[model samples]
Target: MAIRPRTAALFAVILVVTLGVVGVIVHNATRSSTSSSGTVTWWLPDWDWDVATTLVRRFESENPSLHVEMVKTTGGTVANKVSVALDAGNTPDLITESIARTKTYIDKGQLADLTSLYDNAMPASDFAPGLTDVLSVDGKTYAVPYRWATNALIYNTDLFAKAGISGPPTTWPEFINDAKKLTTSTVAGTAWPMQGDPSDLTLRFLDFALQGGTTIKNGTPRFTRDSVEQALELIGTSVVEGYASKSSFELDNTGIRDLFLQGRIAMYLGGVFDADRAVGQKFPVGTAIAPGPSGPGVQEGVGWAYIVPKAAKNLDGAKKLASFLGRPENMASLTLTFPARVSAARDAKFRTDVRKAYGEQLSEHSIPAPNDPRWTAMIPFVHDTIQEVALGSKNPQQGAAAIMTEADKNLGPAQ
Candidate 1:
């Protein structure tokens, strides 16, 4: 499996920090009333330092009034660092973060409202459709998304044509039928990772829950819902019925991709980068939206966004930097994956055949994963139960029930 050993250790520390700190985030937090100097303290992740620093320089050159003091921060630990900083009233003016880590800040009212700043950057319609979802709460926006990506129905065009199938499936029935048609003695249709990092399994299952239109109750989607049962059966039965690959229980994302690249599988739901890897290979790759019970289904994916904290001393400088960075050209330069703006995605670098489906899905059919602190604690419970259901150790009904019972414990008294 491609699961990192260090991730478990990191999560152990984060779970402690997140659970203990989210409750009283604003209790000791002090807000900034008087504006400070023109220097903007921007905490940027180390992963993309080269591009980020260049952009910071560009922003400074364009706007001579504001100077950006770039601070190199680790993306994985920035959330914890920021939380401690907010507690000590030493907040930075700007930071780039994953939506999952940004949720706690947004929930505790520690983030500044970016709705007006976002609109000034670009119209709502101009941005990708479902990508804006996590950045907003109750009709208000708190972050500006620049980089985004999504899962798509990635298929081998040669296998589809050989099977006499015209295109990728758009409904549940068609999806199952296609899986059956694509499967052969030599090739399995698709595979899902059952035993790797729990977060990966949880996100994959959540994609199906979103696609099935599962009703989220009490601000959290319930495992006892009918849609959840359907999702489990749909995935579990496919492997059991021999339509999907039987090796799924042991395969992680990288393992599945290895099989696909070797022509052992026909199609699967995967990230845009999966198709990107298939380019110029032995066979052509085609990508489409994940099918719903009825029509196009929504898949959950993650993205990085720029957020301004409530206690930002240089608010004006942060706002100027955000607006400048949100421009289409700047967005294209910053993103390693698909940019959040449709216009930014129209850049020649992003218009390749493999990139088209991802852009469309991000624009029309994707949503951000539910960003709650408890979700991390709930991951293993959901992952282990889903694996049992898929392997026939328990039926869908029993699996769903088991997941909820274990999860509700970690979820605490609920919001």
Candidate 2:
């Protein structure tokens, strides 16, 4: 009507402000409705950041609406960082951590159940057998595994040739005999980690226990049957007979690996990564499955998985990313170790000699760590007992008894 200039000016200002408010409301509403079109924060170890970045880029290319924010964490500190975040109610959308830790989160109800996603995303038979057990608590899956690292016998081919050993040992008897043959004034036949690090000792012991047919029934460590005592006795005898170095009591896994690299240690049960490291250093290395009493022993390994926190703001986006990362090809590109998916290992890129060895051990002989939340807490007792046996303070029988008592006590009744 243009009755007054002041009135007209006031009306225009009101109209502009109202339109701005409406635009803000519409933007917020669109963002809420399209939950998949948002940023998903990911906390991953620094070592895997390169491959993770590549995977993220690919996912983003396919999902233009979603953005991934990669937060790199140091391996030693990531667990603590994740715990703090969870406690503070500030957890990221996704976390790539050891399966053991992931299980802990599941037990504490901190992570979302991915059982439905796992079932819908891939066929049950496509994954490595028993792979999901590590991330499951009370039969509900909480995470999806991507990469794995397992123990394998890494020997020096040059030293084996010098010792006149024809090939890697096929059984425990041969392993002991070969160790004796490989021992010299300069090099020890084989070395194992006997240091204060309970994890190293626990894993090494588990490899033997599993080979002896030890099983964890309802989260309890059962070592009385299946030649479990014989396995412990074998390790003890190796130490007492001087085939293995006494210094192993002071050395950790890394220390043992270093000795092997320097040609001072002839053989060792080490991670699959050791093969890659040896090859990288131009050292003549040979890989084999750990010898058991009867044949190839069950290998013990730990893996990393992708988990979404219960408090995640971008639940749908996080689930989408988790499923994307689980894709066989994507997982294969992320780690040198065996991929969790069977199809991923069948990819051409995993056909190298080292990868082949790892794949064989994982598929045929691998046993993941016990899916007990108390397993971590029980490592110290197991480690101490093994050290006691190795140092001649106790025999294998006594050591076994002590381990059972301690494990049972700490593990409680088991849920």
Candidate 3:
């Protein structure tokens, strides 16, 4: 097993038993304001409302005086919604978005100072370190992490055994060879969305760069020429050698996952979200931490965060809600997501079994995405460049240079 030594020994063998009855929605009119006083409107990015709704019911149940009305907003431009609302002089009480978009919101004064709230509501050290770093600027914390994820090497156990392989590859070279062996005339070696999908490319490339010991600093991508070339070369090999398809460029997020489910690929690079789906589909899937040049490597902390706007009227109530949810016992019962709180994740029972896998993956190699607001904005364009490079429409070296140029052009000086 390629499981990290620190991780393997940390989790104890404990069986998690669920009750027959799970609470659905306990909706009560617990508005943050009285019927005569008006409501505290909140704008949350569209996600699994099941979790949010559960939390909402709990919040309302605890605080009878305050009622919360929520409006689900589209992702990628949550900051824009906040700005427009501010311009209209009717901002939501609480807003949620990715850490990437949080930068723009913080800069434009659309966010409320969460320093005191973080201190009083949640312990500073409790949350994921990488997430804390991203949400903090100039020593002030701005958000609470709600969800997180990272890439895993999900393989077809049946396929690996049939190919005379015992386990998932632990190094880049081994991965390549195994992928080649897994490649069938009809099925691909592996599949992950590599099209003009910004979200897919940004995360996948970030993981690759981290494996190669590269980092982005001051909004500039940093990697030795060889490392950069090697990273792109790997992508090239996947496509040109037929381990992965050139048609990958045409697949969207859903399309790629669909292909993997249909058994068209032996392996896929994705997160626990996909893992959960595979389990539901009864795919007999085996998972491993994503491997790099080294054994059991991964990059970029993938997860969610919670943020309270400065403009929120019920700041105290909001902070209370955030604190309550972050509690380890409460978090475990409510969601399958790994706890952002270190102490919460430290429990042996929670740290082992099915959840242990997710926990260890986060603790080992959870690097933060580039924090520059402009770089965050340019994620889409970078994905486009990757698609071009992989498809041979653009040379890898030239593509790398073009990425730097485009990034610098869009990401103005941090002054």
Candidate 4:
């Protein structure tokens, strides 16, 4: 999560500001150069520079006929920039971005078909089941899900010991109870991120709602009133009951993590990386399966992927590179977290005590975040309502209704 984590804001800008508007065309597009036949242009996220460079070098050496020109793009800005380039029909041969972003392009027929290459390079059965679904629309693949992660319950063990708590919470009731027990003047029991990136806020809310039967399908939001209210109540009442810090109103995932490390809060529902963050730090950490109302909750698995544009200057070369990157070993190496391929994840790096909960949650209880074209537009409704509800300006009942109302306005009434 952070792969370093984000994009909701970026896509919102793309949908609202860049779509169908080819305003100022910069001479240099964040696009692959169409200068020559053997030059395969790739847009890489800055975080992946080193490892991706090594892989690119290897690719060039192995192929001998093709040279890769990697145009590195920073996170949070890449999506919007790429969207503008796409609107202008200026594209790189390959793009590295969140897999969910592919649906928007595929819907517009802007991506090349990768089904043959994907099957030949990495078979569907080798990946975690359903991982490739995000890259395909109507069973024709368009991208490769290269990286993935799921959330888990990350707790400060020292705090648990000091509070006389025996272990991590195993159920939702126990989770709230633990938060209550951990609360003190010095430390709030837990916290939820209520502000900052609206998309992150939406995902955090869904982290709980997913267990309550909330889902989005084909760009339409879906859930019963009880489930949405229950999800909001857990987040909102935690603050009202004094078991959660009010700082949550201002915190995002990074802010909440900082507070956890500083011991201002005892625990949080966080990404798999959060499970290992306390290593070499003052306090020890523990991870457990994030709990649901009854037991372990279903968490959302999210990550980056490789895509080839239909207008790619080197479509054949782009598909070749995508297939190469999608290989199990390469996928594992490229990902900072878990790879989409199940076989790739059998690598020792993914097998650790701290990451156990991630494995369980992902293999058993996780689902891909829905690929909704309207997700960018719908985030504000979720964000604003959750903030109002948590601050007591509105009750959970009203907050749930607002979300549905917004969803209907943006996505056409849940299909």
Candidate 5:
């Protein structure tokens, strides 16, 4: 099931209650020291559970002294689980989560500083340029980036042909016109994930915002800038005019992707992960950089990073597991995501037209999310304001102004 936004206050309360119960159990277990086996516990999301299990077995076979225990978590619950575990002083030695969310752990001083390991074992230069920086906080490394992805406009080639369109649109006006032409009684011209999940909605907004050169500097949002406002206006107009799917507000990424695979949507912004699935389903998928106000737009790239919490019971073993998973060979074998390591990314499997297109976009036009702890705090506000604009509850100008005000309050004064 898709995760929805929650108030920070509620999350804090859950964390406290969960930690109170777990802390005693952990403290008692550790104090007893009942077992001699050196087992490293890990919490990982369900996306690649099987692949991760295989890799963990291999690592254990290579190092008989260590046994890796994999704890499967879901996308919706993993963050809260990890938070409670950390507060209870019983967090898994290693965990995987989005780089953006991982930063919050680092901000709370809950993550291990992996600078020495990164320097001595996995050199920063071996990774995709700027990735180490993305995973770093205040110049200290805390996590190892595992896989990266950038958003792109994935379209149905068959739909384009039926609509008599030559190719994917490269400008906002063309995009809107093409979307209208692709619309039919049976299928939506385009789709957007307008579900209440802040991360989902905010990422979509950032794609357009970045293309317009919008940046959050010193906690002040630049949404009122002409370029940013224009981008929002385009999306607002498309939704209001019925060029986008009417059910967008109810659907998340997975729901939209299912519709795309069923040929119910002509176009949508998605990542490289969907490319293989589209091909596997025999859909004629065509990918292009997102269209901008006047030309090709910029996209944002982010990834999942592996981290060891500061409260982990098996620190050494955790670091070893992280290092093993980051090896070029293991990374290529286990993950379909674009590898964060430059050397692994060079593998022939990533050279396909779709992957190459995403790579080119990442190298040429992509930007990471704003490097600030409060960025996550601002997401829900941004999501809600965008929803208001898209659903016609607020005009684009009003939505932009409201977003700026909310951002200022949530993000605090510029550092």
Candidate 6:
């Protein structure tokens, strides 16, 4: 690569330094906001600026004494930003879109012990059993779920009819067979993101392991080596065996969803967020639970939760706001997400309007991601190794074995 001009280079260096110094300063500011009297700052992953402003306004309206400042952050950078802000004693009152980092924050003592308030403000008895379970560690609840998203088998009805398949596959073998049958030189049956994208790989494996009836243990992710090995092999079979397209590496969430909607692929694995969009576009499609090696009885649960950092300057206010927002009706209207509270999720309107379409597919076989703090830290490493496996640079067995070893070294030996 050609070198940049000296002025440009100096500017770049200064920018980098500025960001780094700011991050360090924010990290050292550890003041949790508790009272409703002062302004409380909140951070959320980037979204429509208008929607964010509305949310902040709603929150402020609910708690008149508390002024709110909501800043948008990126998912990739939110955890690091929070970490830095807390370290510098300048923490926000609350944060969104860092659900995966709750365990890490709790472990670092950067998150508040919300068990008492969580239990009292919104009794565990009130929320969906699974939601409570997903956020609880040992016996303490550290986060509150706000939005839920999960991968489902989205198939093109037109393609399926032509392929002579009656419906979506209920079992992994059948799924593979269907993919093979529907696949043409131009269209494949299903396309899933690869290990290069650890979220994709992890979520897929979580679904596979859930279908296989496995669970994490002592902060260690449990993969039935034999069954999971077969699952990984299946991915290779999809490509090397000629059932799926090698072009999958080029597709992200949008590409995959677009391909499915455009009838380029017969089936795809993706989240429910696409449902509204799909419906809006009037795409003729049907969704079913992801096919498992076993059968339809297996499915997976995926969603995001809310966590209040211990460094928050307004912990009390934040928790109160969280509680109010978590109220069944409020949550149902604000985000239209599957309410973490069972009562809300079970409400007739909620089920018919929100859960019914996606519930059955997720409930039968929903598994939360690994709760270990190490899993979060080591995800990137795992993702890279997965890419190697997908590229035929490493065998799936060897890839997984390497991951296990890295897990032990980085995640502290499974507990």
Candidate with best TM-score = 4
Local distance difference test, per candidate? 0.79, 0.81, 0.67, 0.82, 0.79, 0.67
Q: Global CA lDDT of candidate 5, please?
A: 0.79
| Per-prediction TM-score | 0.81, 0.87, 0.81, 0.89, 0.83, 0.81
The ten-residue window of minimal lDDT in model 2 covers 218-227
Residue-level lDDT of model 1, residues 196-268, one tens digit each, is 6677767778777766555333235544456667778888888788988899988988888889988889988
Per-residue CA lDDT of candidate 4, range 1-415, in tens? Answer: 4532247777777877664454333323323233467889999899999999999998999888799999989988998977887878899999998866778888988888888975545888776657777677788988878888878899989899998999999899999999999999989899987767787777878777877877756534576677778888998888877898999988988899889999888998888666667764745889888888888788777888888888888898898898889888888888888998888888888988888788887888888887777866777878888878888999999999988777677666653
Clashes of each: 0, 0, 19, 2, 0, 30
For residues 321-377, write the lDDT of model 3, one tens digit per residue.
666666666555544556667766665545533345567777776665666666667
Worst 10 residues of 1 by lDDT: 27-36
Give one digit per residue, the lDDT tens place, for model 2 in 1-415: 5459888899999999999999999999987767644989999888888888888999999998899999998978988999988777788999988876775677678998888776645755677767786677687888888887788889999999988998999898999999999998888999878874678777878778876667765434555533446666877778987899877887888898899999999998888778888989999898888788878888776788888999998988999999999888888888667788888888886666765667788888886777576777878777777777888888888887777666557765322
Candidate 4: C-alpha RMSD to true structure equals 13.9
Off by over 4 Å in 5: 1-37, 216-224, 370-373, 413-415
Q: Which stretches of candidate 4 lie over 4 Å from their true place?
A: 1-35
Query: Which regions of candidate 2 fall more than 4 Å away from where they truly are?
Result: 1-37, 119-121, 218-220, 225-228, 412-415
Residue 5 in candidate 5, Cα distance off native in Å: 74
Clashes of 1: 0
Q: Looking at candidate 5, what is the lDDT of residue 375?
A: 72
**Tens digits of per-residue lDDT for model 5, 169-286:** 9888898899999998888889888875667767778778766666644222344455546666876767888889888888898888999998899998888878778977778999
Could you tell me which 10 consecutive residues in candidate 5 have the lowest summed lDDT?
216-225
- Regions of candidate 6 where Cα sits further than 4 Å from its true position: 1-36, 48-62, 119-121, 297-300, 346-357, 411-415
Clashes by residue pair, model 4: 2-5, 32-92
